[model samples]
Target: MLYFEDLTPGRRFETASHTLTQDEIISFARQFDPQPFHTDPEAAKTSVFDGLAASGWHTSSLTMRLITASELKNVANGLIGMGIKDMRWPQPTRVGDTLRATIEVLAQKASGSKPGFGVVQLRWTTLNQHDEIAMQLETSIWVARRPTEQA
Candidate 1:
Protein backbone atom coordinates (compact mmCIF):
# COMPACT_ATOMS: atom_id res chain seq x y z
CA MET A 1 0.00 0.00 0.00
CA LEU A 2 1.20 3.51 -0.75
CA TYR A 3 1.76 5.72 2.26
CA PHE A 4 1.70 9.49 2.42
CA GLU A 5 5.44 9.59 1.92
CA ASP A 6 5.09 7.94 -1.45
CA LEU A 7 2.72 10.45 -2.91
CA THR A 8 4.69 13.38 -4.29
CA PRO A 9 3.39 16.49 -5.96
CA GLY A 10 2.93 16.09 -9.74
CA ARG A 11 2.70 12.32 -9.45
CA ARG A 12 0.03 11.06 -11.80
CA PHE A 13 -2.02 7.90 -12.20
CA GLU A 14 -4.36 6.88 -15.02
CA THR A 15 -7.02 4.22 -15.20
CA ALA A 16 -8.34 1.99 -17.96
CA SER A 17 -11.24 3.34 -19.97
CA HIS A 18 -14.91 2.47 -19.82
CA THR A 19 -17.40 3.17 -22.60
CA LEU A 20 -20.69 4.78 -21.62
CA THR A 21 -23.46 2.96 -23.40
CA GLN A 22 -26.95 4.37 -23.95
CA ASP A 23 -28.46 1.64 -21.82
CA GLU A 24 -26.08 2.31 -18.98
CA ILE A 25 -26.67 6.05 -19.06
CA ILE A 26 -30.43 5.67 -19.24
CA SER A 27 -30.48 3.16 -16.43
CA PHE A 28 -28.40 5.30 -14.13
CA ALA A 29 -30.43 8.42 -14.84
CA ARG A 30 -33.71 6.61 -14.38
CA GLN A 31 -32.66 5.52 -10.92
CA PHE A 32 -30.92 8.63 -9.63
CA ASP A 33 -31.23 11.62 -11.97
CA PRO A 34 -34.32 11.09 -14.20
CA GLN A 35 -33.79 14.21 -16.30
CA PRO A 36 -35.39 13.86 -19.69
CA PHE A 37 -32.15 14.58 -21.53
CA HIS A 38 -30.48 11.80 -19.64
CA THR A 39 -33.35 9.31 -19.58
CA ASP A 40 -35.15 9.70 -22.91
CA PRO A 41 -33.29 9.76 -26.23
CA GLU A 42 -36.23 11.15 -28.20
CA ALA A 43 -36.83 13.97 -25.75
CA ALA A 44 -33.13 14.73 -25.61
CA LYS A 45 -32.93 15.53 -29.32
CA THR A 46 -34.33 18.95 -28.60
CA SER A 47 -32.49 19.49 -25.35
CA VAL A 48 -29.38 21.61 -25.22
CA PHE A 49 -27.30 18.50 -25.40
CA ASP A 50 -29.00 17.72 -28.73
CA GLY A 51 -28.85 14.04 -27.86
CA LEU A 52 -29.06 11.71 -24.92
CA ALA A 53 -26.52 12.82 -22.38
CA ALA A 54 -25.22 11.16 -19.28
CA SER A 55 -25.88 12.97 -16.07
CA GLY A 56 -22.90 14.72 -14.54
CA TRP A 57 -23.36 12.62 -11.42
CA HIS A 58 -23.22 9.47 -13.51
CA THR A 59 -19.97 10.59 -15.05
CA SER A 60 -18.59 11.29 -11.60
CA SER A 61 -19.70 7.89 -10.40
CA LEU A 62 -18.01 6.19 -13.34
CA THR A 63 -14.83 8.12 -12.67
CA MET A 64 -14.87 6.93 -9.08
CA ARG A 65 -15.36 3.38 -10.25
CA LEU A 66 -12.42 3.59 -12.65
CA ILE A 67 -10.11 5.03 -10.00
CA THR A 68 -11.05 2.46 -7.38
CA ALA A 69 -10.46 -0.35 -9.85
CA SER A 70 -7.02 0.93 -10.76
CA GLU A 71 -3.72 0.19 -9.05
CA LEU A 72 -3.79 3.58 -7.35
CA LYS A 73 -6.54 2.30 -5.12
CA ASN A 74 -3.80 0.38 -3.31
CA VAL A 75 -3.09 3.48 -1.28
CA ALA A 76 -3.79 2.81 2.38
CA ASN A 77 -6.13 -0.02 1.33
CA GLY A 78 -8.50 2.68 0.06
CA LEU A 79 -8.58 6.38 -0.61
CA ILE A 80 -10.10 8.16 2.34
CA GLY A 81 -11.41 11.44 1.01
CA MET A 82 -11.45 14.54 3.11
CA GLY A 83 -13.56 16.63 0.74
CA ILE A 84 -14.03 17.76 -2.84
CA LYS A 85 -13.50 21.20 -4.36
CA ASP A 86 -13.78 22.99 -7.71
CA MET A 87 -15.81 20.23 -9.36
CA ARG A 88 -16.80 21.12 -12.94
CA TRP A 89 -18.44 19.36 -15.83
CA PRO A 90 -17.21 21.11 -18.94
CA GLN A 91 -18.86 18.92 -21.53
CA PRO A 92 -21.78 16.53 -21.71
CA THR A 93 -20.92 12.87 -21.85
CA ARG A 94 -22.81 11.19 -24.65
CA VAL A 95 -23.74 7.61 -25.45
CA GLY A 96 -20.88 5.33 -26.56
CA ASP A 97 -18.32 7.76 -25.26
CA THR A 98 -15.27 5.99 -23.88
CA LEU A 99 -14.13 7.64 -20.70
CA ARG A 100 -10.79 7.62 -18.95
CA ALA A 101 -9.61 9.22 -15.74
CA THR A 102 -6.39 10.73 -14.45
CA ILE A 103 -5.39 11.58 -10.92
CA GLU A 104 -2.57 14.01 -10.14
CA VAL A 105 -1.12 14.66 -6.74
CA LEU A 106 -1.10 18.42 -6.15
CA ALA A 107 0.29 18.68 -2.65
CA GLN A 108 0.61 16.90 0.70
CA LYS A 109 0.85 17.97 4.27
CA ALA A 110 0.97 16.18 7.58
CA SER A 111 -2.34 16.30 9.36
CA GLY A 112 -2.20 18.81 12.20
CA SER A 113 -4.55 16.84 14.39
CA LYS A 114 -4.22 13.35 13.02
CA PRO A 115 -0.67 12.27 13.53
CA GLY A 116 0.45 9.32 11.38
CA PHE A 117 -1.74 10.62 8.60
CA GLY A 118 -1.52 13.32 5.98
CA VAL A 119 -3.88 15.25 3.76
CA VAL A 120 -3.07 14.88 0.08
CA GLN A 121 -4.43 17.32 -2.43
CA LEU A 122 -5.37 15.72 -5.71
CA ARG A 123 -6.80 16.79 -9.07
CA TRP A 124 -9.02 14.37 -10.92
CA THR A 125 -9.67 14.77 -14.65
CA THR A 126 -12.08 12.74 -16.70
CA LEU A 127 -11.89 12.79 -20.49
CA ASN A 128 -13.90 11.34 -23.30
CA GLN A 129 -12.60 9.31 -26.26
CA HIS A 130 -11.87 12.53 -28.16
CA ASP A 131 -9.78 13.76 -25.24
CA GLU A 132 -12.39 16.33 -24.38
CA ILE A 133 -12.61 16.99 -20.70
CA ALA A 134 -15.97 15.90 -19.38
CA MET A 135 -15.39 16.54 -15.70
CA GLN A 136 -12.73 17.70 -13.30
CA LEU A 137 -12.41 18.15 -9.57
CA GLU A 138 -9.96 18.78 -6.79
CA THR A 139 -10.12 16.78 -3.60
CA SER A 140 -8.18 16.07 -0.47
CA ILE A 141 -7.57 12.55 0.78
CA TRP A 142 -6.32 11.34 4.13
CA VAL A 143 -3.39 9.04 3.64
CA ALA A 144 -1.62 7.05 6.29
CA ARG A 145 1.99 7.98 6.96
CA ARG A 146 4.64 5.33 6.79
CA PRO A 147 4.95 3.47 10.05
CA THR A 148 8.22 3.89 11.95
CA GLU A 149 10.37 0.81 11.68
CA GLN A 150 11.96 -0.80 14.69
CA ALA A 151 15.64 0.05 15.06
Candidate 2:
Protein backbone atom coordinates (compact mmCIF):
# COMPACT_ATOMS: atom_id res chain seq x y z
CA MET A 1 0.00 0.00 0.00
CA LEU A 2 1.18 3.48 -0.78
CA TYR A 3 1.76 5.93 2.01
CA PHE A 4 3.02 9.48 2.36
CA GLU A 5 6.57 8.24 2.04
CA ASP A 6 5.86 6.75 -1.36
CA LEU A 7 5.33 10.18 -2.87
CA THR A 8 8.82 11.50 -3.25
CA PRO A 9 9.12 15.05 -4.44
CA GLY A 10 9.89 15.32 -8.18
CA ARG A 11 8.81 11.72 -8.79
CA ARG A 12 6.33 11.22 -11.59
CA PHE A 13 3.54 8.72 -12.06
CA GLU A 14 1.62 7.97 -15.23
CA THR A 15 -1.84 6.75 -16.08
CA ALA A 16 -2.59 4.09 -18.64
CA SER A 17 -4.01 5.05 -21.99
CA HIS A 18 -7.72 5.35 -22.78
CA THR A 19 -9.68 6.64 -25.72
CA LEU A 20 -12.51 9.18 -25.68
CA THR A 21 -15.64 8.07 -27.52
CA GLN A 22 -18.32 10.22 -29.11
CA ASP A 23 -21.17 8.48 -27.37
CA GLU A 24 -19.41 8.57 -24.06
CA ILE A 25 -18.86 12.29 -24.33
CA ILE A 26 -22.44 12.93 -25.32
CA SER A 27 -23.83 10.70 -22.64
CA PHE A 28 -21.72 12.21 -19.89
CA ALA A 29 -22.44 15.75 -20.98
CA ARG A 30 -26.15 15.18 -21.34
CA GLN A 31 -26.39 13.92 -17.81
CA PHE A 32 -24.15 16.45 -16.14
CA ASP A 33 -22.73 19.27 -18.22
CA PRO A 34 -25.12 19.73 -21.19
CA GLN A 35 -23.10 22.36 -23.02
CA PRO A 36 -23.41 22.89 -26.78
CA PHE A 37 -19.79 22.04 -27.36
CA HIS A 38 -20.18 18.78 -25.50
CA THR A 39 -23.45 17.25 -26.67
CA ASP A 40 -23.65 17.84 -30.43
CA PRO A 41 -20.92 17.89 -33.04
CA GLU A 42 -22.64 20.28 -35.46
CA ALA A 43 -23.62 22.66 -32.74
CA ALA A 44 -20.14 22.41 -31.32
CA LYS A 45 -18.63 23.35 -34.68
CA THR A 46 -20.48 26.65 -34.68
CA SER A 47 -20.23 27.12 -30.96
CA VAL A 48 -16.64 28.47 -30.85
CA PHE A 49 -15.03 25.19 -29.90
CA ASP A 50 -15.08 24.05 -33.57
CA GLY A 51 -16.07 20.44 -32.80
CA LEU A 52 -17.83 18.24 -30.33
CA ALA A 53 -15.98 18.09 -27.05
CA ALA A 54 -16.06 16.35 -23.75
CA SER A 55 -17.16 18.16 -20.64
CA GLY A 56 -14.41 19.39 -18.36
CA TRP A 57 -15.88 17.23 -15.62
CA HIS A 58 -15.81 14.23 -17.96
CA THR A 59 -12.10 14.78 -18.50
CA SER A 60 -11.64 14.92 -14.74
CA SER A 61 -13.54 11.65 -14.39
CA LEU A 62 -11.31 10.04 -16.98
CA THR A 63 -8.36 11.21 -14.93
CA MET A 64 -9.85 9.51 -11.92
CA ARG A 65 -10.19 6.20 -13.78
CA LEU A 66 -6.66 6.41 -15.03
CA ILE A 67 -5.33 7.18 -11.57
CA THR A 68 -7.23 4.27 -10.04
CA ALA A 69 -5.94 1.91 -12.69
CA SER A 70 -2.38 3.02 -12.08
CA GLU A 71 -2.25 1.39 -8.63
CA LEU A 72 -2.94 4.62 -6.81
CA LYS A 73 -5.73 2.80 -5.02
CA ASN A 74 -3.13 1.61 -2.57
CA VAL A 75 -3.41 4.72 -0.45
CA ALA A 76 -7.14 5.27 -0.97
CA ASN A 77 -7.39 7.77 1.88
CA GLY A 78 -10.81 8.78 0.57
CA LEU A 79 -8.93 11.86 -0.59
CA ILE A 80 -10.18 15.03 0.96
CA GLY A 81 -9.77 17.39 -1.96
CA MET A 82 -9.17 20.80 -0.41
CA GLY A 83 -9.61 22.56 -3.73
CA ILE A 84 -8.05 23.10 -7.14
CA LYS A 85 -6.05 26.08 -8.26
CA ASP A 86 -5.62 27.76 -11.65
CA MET A 87 -7.81 25.20 -13.35
CA ARG A 88 -8.19 25.93 -17.07
CA TRP A 89 -9.56 23.70 -19.83
CA PRO A 90 -7.01 24.56 -22.47
CA GLN A 91 -7.90 22.66 -25.68
CA PRO A 92 -11.03 20.65 -26.25
CA THR A 93 -10.80 16.88 -26.26
CA ARG A 94 -12.35 15.34 -29.33
CA VAL A 95 -14.02 11.96 -29.67
CA GLY A 96 -11.86 8.97 -30.66
CA ASP A 97 -8.81 10.73 -29.26
CA THR A 98 -6.73 8.58 -26.98
CA LEU A 99 -5.35 10.11 -23.79
CA ARG A 100 -2.85 9.44 -21.05
CA ALA A 101 -1.67 11.51 -18.12
CA THR A 102 1.31 12.15 -15.91
CA ILE A 103 1.24 13.31 -12.32
CA GLU A 104 4.28 15.09 -10.98
CA VAL A 105 4.86 15.24 -7.28
CA LEU A 106 4.97 18.96 -6.77
CA ALA A 107 5.18 18.93 -3.02
CA GLN A 108 4.53 16.88 0.12
CA LYS A 109 4.51 17.93 3.72
CA ALA A 110 3.20 17.11 7.14
CA SER A 111 -0.25 18.17 8.17
CA GLY A 112 -0.58 20.92 10.72
CA SER A 113 -2.17 18.74 13.36
CA LYS A 114 -2.93 15.39 11.83
CA PRO A 115 0.19 13.71 13.14
CA GLY A 116 -0.48 10.43 11.39
CA PHE A 117 -1.24 11.97 8.02
CA GLY A 118 0.26 14.33 5.47
CA VAL A 119 -0.72 15.97 2.23
CA VAL A 120 0.63 15.54 -1.28
CA GLN A 121 0.32 18.13 -3.97
CA LEU A 122 0.49 17.29 -7.64
CA ARG A 123 -0.20 18.76 -11.04
CA TRP A 124 -1.33 16.48 -13.82
CA THR A 125 -1.75 16.91 -17.53
CA THR A 126 -3.59 14.69 -19.98
CA LEU A 127 -2.18 14.42 -23.45
CA ASN A 128 -3.88 13.18 -26.58
CA GLN A 129 -2.23 10.64 -28.87
CA HIS A 130 -0.79 13.46 -30.93
CA ASP A 131 0.93 14.68 -27.76
CA GLU A 132 -1.46 17.57 -27.47
CA ILE A 133 -2.49 18.55 -23.97
CA ALA A 134 -6.23 18.26 -23.54
CA MET A 135 -6.57 19.04 -19.88
CA GLN A 136 -4.61 19.92 -16.79
CA LEU A 137 -5.29 20.43 -13.09
CA GLU A 138 -3.64 20.75 -9.72
CA THR A 139 -4.75 18.59 -6.82
CA SER A 140 -3.93 17.46 -3.33
CA ILE A 141 -4.66 14.36 -1.28
CA TRP A 142 -4.42 13.51 2.37
CA VAL A 143 -2.25 10.47 3.02
CA ALA A 144 -1.66 8.43 6.11
CA ARG A 145 1.95 7.72 6.82
CA ARG A 146 3.56 4.46 7.84
CA PRO A 147 3.17 4.43 11.61
CA THR A 148 6.14 5.99 13.34
CA GLU A 149 6.18 2.90 15.53
CA GLN A 150 6.89 0.83 12.41
CA ALA A 151 9.70 3.15 11.45
Candidate 3:
Protein backbone atom coordinates (compact mmCIF):
# COMPACT_ATOMS: atom_id res chain seq x y z
CA MET A 1 0.00 0.00 0.00
CA LEU A 2 1.23 3.46 -0.85
CA TYR A 3 1.25 6.04 1.93
CA PHE A 4 2.37 9.58 2.50
CA GLU A 5 5.76 8.42 3.73
CA ASP A 6 6.32 6.30 0.64
CA LEU A 7 5.91 9.16 -1.83
CA THR A 8 9.15 11.09 -2.23
CA PRO A 9 10.03 14.01 -4.46
CA GLY A 10 11.21 12.89 -7.91
CA ARG A 11 9.51 9.49 -7.51
CA ARG A 12 7.95 8.42 -10.80
CA PHE A 13 5.35 5.90 -11.93
CA GLU A 14 4.17 4.82 -15.38
CA THR A 15 0.79 3.52 -16.51
CA ALA A 16 -0.28 1.02 -19.11
CA SER A 17 -1.06 2.20 -22.61
CA HIS A 18 -4.44 2.94 -24.21
CA THR A 19 -4.93 3.38 -27.93
CA LEU A 20 -7.44 5.91 -29.15
CA THR A 21 -10.02 4.64 -31.59
CA GLN A 22 -11.99 6.85 -34.00
CA ASP A 23 -15.30 5.46 -32.86
CA GLU A 24 -14.51 6.03 -29.21
CA ILE A 25 -13.16 9.50 -29.89
CA ILE A 26 -16.23 10.51 -31.80
CA SER A 27 -18.48 8.97 -29.19
CA PHE A 28 -16.78 10.79 -26.35
CA ALA A 29 -16.79 14.12 -28.14
CA ARG A 30 -20.36 13.77 -29.30
CA GLN A 31 -21.45 13.36 -25.72
CA PHE A 32 -19.23 15.78 -23.86
CA ASP A 33 -17.43 18.28 -26.08
CA PRO A 34 -19.45 18.25 -29.34
CA GLN A 35 -16.84 20.32 -31.13
CA PRO A 36 -16.37 19.87 -34.85
CA PHE A 37 -12.66 19.27 -34.54
CA HIS A 38 -13.35 16.50 -32.08
CA THR A 39 -16.50 14.97 -33.52
CA ASP A 40 -16.54 15.61 -37.28
CA PRO A 41 -13.54 14.61 -39.29
CA GLU A 42 -14.48 16.53 -42.44
CA ALA A 43 -15.15 19.69 -40.46
CA ALA A 44 -11.91 19.20 -38.58
CA LYS A 45 -10.03 19.31 -41.89
CA THR A 46 -11.02 22.97 -42.15
CA SER A 47 -10.26 23.70 -38.51
CA VAL A 48 -6.84 24.44 -37.04
CA PHE A 49 -6.18 20.81 -36.31
CA ASP A 50 -6.70 19.75 -39.96
CA GLY A 51 -8.01 16.44 -38.67
CA LEU A 52 -10.17 14.86 -36.00
CA ALA A 53 -8.78 15.29 -32.53
CA ALA A 54 -9.83 14.01 -29.16
CA SER A 55 -11.16 16.57 -26.78
CA GLY A 56 -8.75 17.72 -24.10
CA TRP A 57 -11.23 16.66 -21.46
CA HIS A 58 -11.33 13.21 -23.02
CA THR A 59 -7.57 12.94 -22.76
CA SER A 60 -7.67 14.00 -19.12
CA SER A 61 -10.37 11.43 -18.39
CA LEU A 62 -8.28 8.71 -20.00
CA THR A 63 -5.31 9.76 -17.92
CA MET A 64 -7.39 9.53 -14.77
CA ARG A 65 -8.50 6.04 -15.70
CA LEU A 66 -4.93 4.91 -16.31
CA ILE A 67 -3.75 6.39 -13.02
CA THR A 68 -6.53 4.72 -11.07
CA ALA A 69 -5.99 1.36 -12.71
CA SER A 70 -2.21 1.34 -12.52
CA GLU A 71 -1.31 3.24 -9.37
CA LEU A 72 -4.17 4.28 -7.09
CA LYS A 73 -5.87 0.89 -7.06
CA ASN A 74 -3.21 -0.44 -4.70
CA VAL A 75 -3.00 2.58 -2.45
CA ALA A 76 -4.44 2.10 1.01
CA ASN A 77 -7.12 4.55 2.18
CA GLY A 78 -7.36 5.79 -1.44
CA LEU A 79 -6.61 9.37 -2.44
CA ILE A 80 -8.66 12.53 -2.22
CA GLY A 81 -7.91 15.08 -4.89
CA MET A 82 -7.24 18.52 -3.46
CA GLY A 83 -6.93 20.51 -6.68
CA ILE A 84 -5.44 20.67 -10.18
CA LYS A 85 -3.18 23.33 -11.60
CA ASP A 86 -1.57 24.39 -14.87
CA MET A 87 -3.38 21.88 -17.06
CA ARG A 88 -2.32 22.12 -20.71
CA TRP A 89 -2.83 20.14 -23.90
CA PRO A 90 0.44 20.63 -25.66
CA GLN A 91 -0.32 18.30 -28.55
CA PRO A 92 -3.55 17.01 -29.98
CA THR A 93 -4.57 13.43 -29.33
CA ARG A 94 -5.73 12.01 -32.64
CA VAL A 95 -7.31 8.73 -33.61
CA GLY A 96 -5.03 5.66 -33.50
CA ASP A 97 -2.66 7.33 -31.06
CA THR A 98 -1.55 5.08 -28.26
CA LEU A 99 -1.15 6.94 -25.00
CA ARG A 100 0.37 6.32 -21.60
CA ALA A 101 0.78 8.33 -18.47
CA THR A 102 3.61 9.12 -16.09
CA ILE A 103 3.52 10.87 -12.77
CA GLU A 104 6.31 12.41 -10.71
CA VAL A 105 6.05 13.47 -7.12
CA LEU A 106 6.96 17.13 -6.92
CA ALA A 107 6.52 17.94 -3.25
CA GLN A 108 4.68 16.85 -0.13
CA LYS A 109 3.80 18.17 3.28
CA ALA A 110 2.11 16.67 6.30
CA SER A 111 -1.26 18.25 6.86
CA GLY A 112 -1.25 20.42 9.95
CA SER A 113 -4.98 20.31 10.43
CA LYS A 114 -5.24 16.63 9.62
CA PRO A 115 -2.41 14.88 11.34
CA GLY A 116 -3.19 11.54 9.76
CA PHE A 117 -2.88 12.82 6.22
CA GLY A 118 -0.47 14.65 3.97
CA VAL A 119 -0.79 16.73 0.82
CA VAL A 120 1.31 15.60 -2.13
CA GLN A 121 1.86 17.58 -5.31
CA LEU A 122 2.37 15.58 -8.47
CA ARG A 123 3.17 16.41 -12.06
CA TRP A 124 1.29 14.26 -14.54
CA THR A 125 2.36 13.89 -18.15
CA THR A 126 0.54 11.89 -20.81
CA LEU A 127 2.58 10.82 -23.79
CA ASN A 128 1.60 9.39 -27.14
CA GLN A 129 3.17 6.45 -29.05
CA HIS A 130 5.93 8.67 -30.39
CA ASP A 131 6.76 9.89 -26.89
CA GLU A 132 5.27 13.28 -27.64
CA ILE A 133 3.55 14.83 -24.67
CA ALA A 134 -0.18 15.13 -25.22
CA MET A 135 -1.33 16.60 -21.94
CA GLN A 136 0.21 17.76 -18.68
CA LEU A 137 -1.12 18.87 -15.34
CA GLU A 138 -0.12 19.41 -11.75
CA THR A 139 -2.37 18.28 -8.96
CA SER A 140 -2.41 17.84 -5.22
CA ILE A 141 -3.92 14.95 -3.35
CA TRP A 142 -4.43 13.98 0.25
CA VAL A 143 -2.76 10.73 1.23
CA ALA A 144 -3.18 8.88 4.47
CA ARG A 145 -0.24 8.37 6.75
CA ARG A 146 0.69 5.16 8.48
CA PRO A 147 -0.93 4.74 11.86
CA THR A 148 1.37 5.41 14.77
CA GLU A 149 1.97 2.61 17.23
CA GLN A 150 0.94 3.47 20.77
CA ALA A 151 3.66 3.38 23.36
Among these predictions, the greatest lDDT belongs to 1
- Candidate 3 has an lDDT of 0.93
lDDT of 1 by residue, 1-24 (tens): 899999999999999999989999
Q: Model 1 TM-score?
A: 0.97
Question: Highest TM-score: which candidate?
Answer: 1
Each prediction's RMSD to truth: 0.8, 1.7, 1.0
Per-model tally of clashing residue pairs: 0, 0, 0
Where model 1 places Cα greater than 4 Å from the true spot, the runs are none
Off by over 4 Å in 2: 76-78
TM-scores of the candidates in the order shown: 0.97, 0.92, 0.97
Candidate 2 C-alpha lDDT tens digits along 44-69: 98987788989989988898789878
Residue 89's C-alpha lDDT in candidate 2?
72
Q: Write the per-residue lDDT of candidate 3 for residues 14-131, one digit (tens) a residue.
A: 9999999999999999999999999999999999998999999999999999999887666667767889999999989999999999999999999999999999899999999999
List clashing residue pairs in candidate 3.
none
Better of 1 and 2 by lDDT: 1
State each model's CA lDDT, in order: 0.95, 0.85, 0.93
Error of 2 at 45 (Å): 2.0
